[model samples]
Each structure stands twice: as C-alpha cells, then as structure tokens.
Target: MLQSFYLILCILGFVLPYSQFVPFLLEHGLDIKLFFEQLFANRISGFFGMDVAVSSLVLWTFVFWEGTRLKMRYLWVYVVCNLLVGVSFGLPLFLLIRQRQVEQQTD
Candidate 1:
C-alpha cells in the first residue's frame, strides 16, 4: 500500500512537471534549446527521469515480490528482468528518494 502510494507520487512528480509546466513554457514561446540546455545544466532532466525510473522499479518490485510470495514460479524470470530494469534505470532515483525519506523521518 505504501509502496503503491509512493509509486503514484513519483509518477505524478514526473508527469505533472512535464505535461503541465513544460507545455506552458513552450506555449509562452520559450526557446526549446535554451530550455533544454538550462534544464540539463541544472540537472532537472536527470532528476525527473530518475523519478520516473524509480517509480517504475518500485511498482515492479512490489509486483514481483507479491508474485513470488504467491509461489508463482514462472515469475522468477520477470523478477530478474524487473530488477535489471530497476538497476539500470531506477536505482539512483530509488536511492535518492529512499535517503530523503530516511532523513525526513529521522529529523
């Protein structure tokens, strides 16, 4: 349940900014290249891409864990694949968010 909520939140973080704010900026005549360069230099793209990746991982992890718990042997392959995807794309974002949550709770 908590994992699901986190996954949704992470996805929203990515979608909202891109779909809402990015389009608004573009409609207002923002230069695409300059916008991208600024975004890249400040690491915003990396941050948001990581957010999406981590959310995907969290969602898949929950799925695989549940499948395994249910004795679904066929899902082992899926688990491996999901883990690979997560590590390739989601690990950094996962770590970042996990660390943030830990810090917030500790504080």
Candidate 2:
C-alpha cells in the first residue's frame, strides 16, 4: 500500500510537469540549441534554471550517500530516470525503491 502511494506520487509528478513542458516543446520545435537559448534568455529564466540545477545537485548527492549507505538496489535507475525525465519523476521513483528496500529489511 505504501508502495502504491509512492507510485501514484510518481505518476502525478510526471503528469503535472509534462502538462507544461510538453506544450513548450511542441511550440518550440524541440531544438536543443533553441531550448538552451530560451532557458537563459531572461533574468527569471536564469534564476529558475540555476535554482533547479543546484537543487538537483543537492538531491543527487543525498541520493548517492543514502543509497550507498543502505546498499540500495537500482541506484542507477534513479539517476538515469532523473536525467531522462526530471526530478519530479525520479525522486518519487527513488523513494518508492527505497521504501521497498526498507520493507524488505523488516521482513
């Protein structure tokens, strides 16, 4: 049941953010150079992107530390998913995996 909760969180996370990002990509032509150009075009964009970068770095650091300490399986899965999608999807996915590990240890 707890795992289900995390899975639901992951699904919502992806759905909510992509609802915005997908439209942007469609409108912007999915060009990598154009994406980066616009990502830093304004002060707000710069601040927001940098903030996300810093936060993602912090999150990954904690992920590595805790995952290593607990010998968590599929640690790379979280990292890869974070890169491919976004933190919204990856964080909850990692939490779900971590929760499963905790449950296993108790069993």
Candidate 3:
C-alpha cells in the first residue's frame, strides 16, 4: 500500500511538473536565464530553492552512504530520480524501496 502510494506520488510529480515545464519550454525555447530569474525572483522563492538544495545534498549523501553500507543495488537509480525528479517524488520512493528491503531482511 505504501509502495503504491509512493508510486502514485512519483507519477504525479513527473506529470504535474512536466505539465507546466513542457509548455514553458515550448514557449521560451530553453531559457536558462529566465528559469533562474523566476526561481530566485523573490525571497520566498529563494528560500524554497535553498531548502530544496540543502535537502538534496543531504539526500544524496544519505543515499550514497546507506546504499553502500547495505550493499544495495539501484543506488544510482535513487540519485538520478532525486536529481531528475523532485524530492517529493524521490524521497517517498526511496522510503518505499527501503521499507521493502528491510522487510525482506526480517523475513
């Protein structure tokens, strides 16, 4: 059930953002400067960006260390998902995968 929930969230994460970004890109033609301008346009936006940036660093570090410690495959998968997808998607997805791995060990 949790896995299903996370999967749903993951799917929505991609779907919802692509819904906007695709259209924006189509209209803007890969406007990197405008992207950053909008991203850090205000203090609130900058705060959120900083929040995500810090959390991403933390998440990547955890994924790397924990993955190696557990000898887990698909470590890169988590990293890529975190980078390419949002943390809203990646963290829940990672939790789901980690839960399954732990359950397997207990069994």
Best by TM-score: 3
- Runs of candidate 1 with Cα error greater than 4 angstroms are 1-42, 79-107
Best by lDDT: 2
- List model 3 lDDT by residue over 24-54, tens digit each: 7899988999988988999999998889889
Per-residue lDDT for 9-100 in model 2, tens only? 99987898789779888898778898788889999999988886786787688789888887897678887777767788888888888888
Error of 3 at 98 (Å): 1.4
TM match of model 3 to true structure: 0.84
Error of 3 at 36 (Å): 0.8
The better candidate by TM-score, 1 or 2, is 2
lDDT of 1 by residue, 35-106 (tens): 556546657786865675676667567545654444444544433533444333243334344545555657
Identify the superior model by lDDT, candidate 1 or candidate 2: 2
Model 2: lDDT of residue 78: 81
Better of 2 and 3 by lDDT: 2
Candidates in order, TM-scores: namely 0.29, 0.83, 0.84
How close is each model in CA RMSD to the real structure? 11.1, 1.9, 1.7
Query: How much lDDT does candidate 1 score?
Result: 0.53
Worst 10-residue lDDT window for candidate 2 reads 77-86
